[model samples]
Target: MVVTRFAPSPNGSLHLGHAFSAIAAHDIAQERGGRFLLRIEDIDGERSMPEKAAEFRKDLAWLGLEWEEVPAQSTRLANYEEAAQYLLHEGLLYPCTCTRKDIAARNPRMGPEGAVYPGTCKGQSLDPDKPAALRLDVDRAMAGLGELSWEDEVGGTQIADPRPFGDVVLVRKDAPASYHLAATLDDAADGVTLVTRGEDLFSSTHVHRVLQELLGLPVPTWHHHPILLDEEDEKLAKRRCSPSLADRRAAGEDGRALARQLRMGEFPAGITQSNA
Candidate 1:
């Protein structure tokens, strides 16, 4: 059976973009008689709000989307640690002590996630007691995997190349697991057969695919649907203060009607759609 998931971080209220993504995953599963799952990505330490997770559930329920709940990342620290240990044992990971300032000073080229890590600590020998983040040796990993690829429901087969992101962090000093590490593990653990989210995360799939290969996790197909955009053609993001779904609900908007409009490619005023 196909299983899809809508994993959201509870750092803020759910916005239209989030609602659209959830509805997309839910509808896909319902159409196929498959299972749709929900996961709370509250692994950002104090920045993650448990209360917001409750609000996220309320927003999804209000939108008429149903999903089976899964264990949040905060509850799966051991799983992430175990995976990290396995990679460390295999020499596919190294301790990185580079701070954000350290990376910026290197004049590194830009990548999907801000400035690409310059591999400053790639081959450095470090103290075990020093505070550091664990980074995946993407070069060595891809060398071992020997040309990997994944299928996308819309884009079809995509050759995986994670080198552009540099040696991505698997575990950080402040957090138990990075999104790349936790999301990949959680998807496999939940028996997800299809991963669906916005197209902006399309590049992230490369990093996730490499993690899946290194961790010996099950591979699932992906469907990166179009993202909802604002009047300025910017992707609707919580950080930008986009109008939230909770706000719409509070105004007595019809949740089911809004969902139907989204399904028909109709969006509210000032909100547009973009696949780029």
Candidate 2:
């Protein structure tokens, strides 16, 4: 059976961009008579609010989206740890003690997530007791997997090139699992067949594909739909204080109507759509 999921972090309220992504995944699953799942990405111990996850379910339901709820990432820490340990044991991961300042001092080239790591701690013999984040040896991983590619519903077949991301951290010093490791493992564990999200995450998929190969996880097809932008043509993000779906609901706006508008590519005033 085809399976798709809408995984959202509960650090903030759901906004229009979140609605668009959720409706897309929900509709796709409904149309294909497949399963639609909801994953609460509440692994951020510092920022994740338990109450916000409940709000997410309310918002999604108000939007007329139904999904099979999966256990939150917070409840699956051991699974992520096991995956990280496997990668580390296989020599595909290394512990890095580099601070942000240490990376900046290297004058490293910029990638999607700021300065690409210089691999300063790639082969460094460090004390096991010292705190360190685990980073994937992307170069070595690709060399072992050889060339790889993944299919996109709209973009067709695309080659996976994770070199630009450099060695991304799979386990952070502060968190049990980074987004890259947690999401990849969760998708496979949940038996997801299609991954759906905003187009802004397209680059991240390359790194995810590599992780899937290294961890021997099943690869899921992806559908990166357009993102909603504000009047200034900036992508709507929580950090920017975009108006949330809950706020509109509080104002007595009909959520089902909003979902229909999003489905038809019609957005509220001051909001626009962009493939970027």
Candidate 3:
């Protein structure tokens, strides 16, 4: 069966960006006869507040999107740890103690996201008691991946070289799995087959693909969609809260009003009673 997800971090409220993703994933589920899941990507304990998660849930429900159940990252920590260990056991992961300054000093040129990790301490001996983040060996995976291309729902076919992402951090020193690691694991665990999110995340797919291969999971097909940008053409951050969902609901926002604002343009949507 086809399964898709809108895995949002509960670090902030649902804004225009959230609604765009919610509708995109929901519409895809409808089209594929699939389940549209809502997974909380709150791996960072410091950031995830109970009230924020509650508010995020209410906001999505108010927007006419529903899910199977709430599977939180903190509760699913064991699974992430097990996955990390498995990668370590397979020699796909290595510990690095390089600080941010060390990384930039080694490689000044950065990719789209930021400075490509220089792999300074990649092969260096480290104290067992010292803290370290688990990093995926990109070159090893790249040898298997080569040049890859994915189909985007909005932007058409895309090709990636995979050199820029370099080695991505899978697990932080504190054992909180990075978003790339946790999302791939949760998506596979939830049996997510089609991933629908903003185009801005397209670059991150290289990291996800590498981990999927390292972990022996079948990589899901990607459909990176258009982002809802602001007047300055910057990626909209929920902190602005200009056309806030809460404000909209207070002003009587419902499915139709949301659709119009989101440019989803009314094709019949609801909090449908489905397996999702």
Give the alpha carbon lDDT tens digit for every residue of 1-276 in model 1: 889999999888889999899999999999999999999999998889899888888888888888999999889999999999999888989999989999999999999998999888987654778999999898888887888899999899999999889989999989999989999999999999999999999999999998888878999999999999999999999899998888888899989888889888898889888953
Compared to the true structure, candidate 3 yields what TM-score? 0.86
Candidate number with the higher lDDT (1 or 3):
1
lDDT at 234, model 1: 94
**Candidate 1: where are CA atoms >4 Å away?**
none
Off by over 4 Å in 2: none
TM-score sort, best first? 2, 1, 3
Writing each residue's lDDT as its tens digit, candidate 3 over 122-165 gives: 76543679888888777776776667666556666767556687
lDDT of each: 0.91, 0.92, 0.73
Q: Write candidate 2's Cα lDDT for 115-168 as tens digits.
A: 999999998653679999999889889897878899999889989998998999
lDDT of 3: 0.73
Question: What's the C-alpha lDDT at position 41 in model 3?
Answer: 81
Tell me the TM-score of model 1.
0.97
**Ten-residue region with minimum lDDT total, candidate 2:** 120-129
Residue 101 of model 2, lDDT score? 99
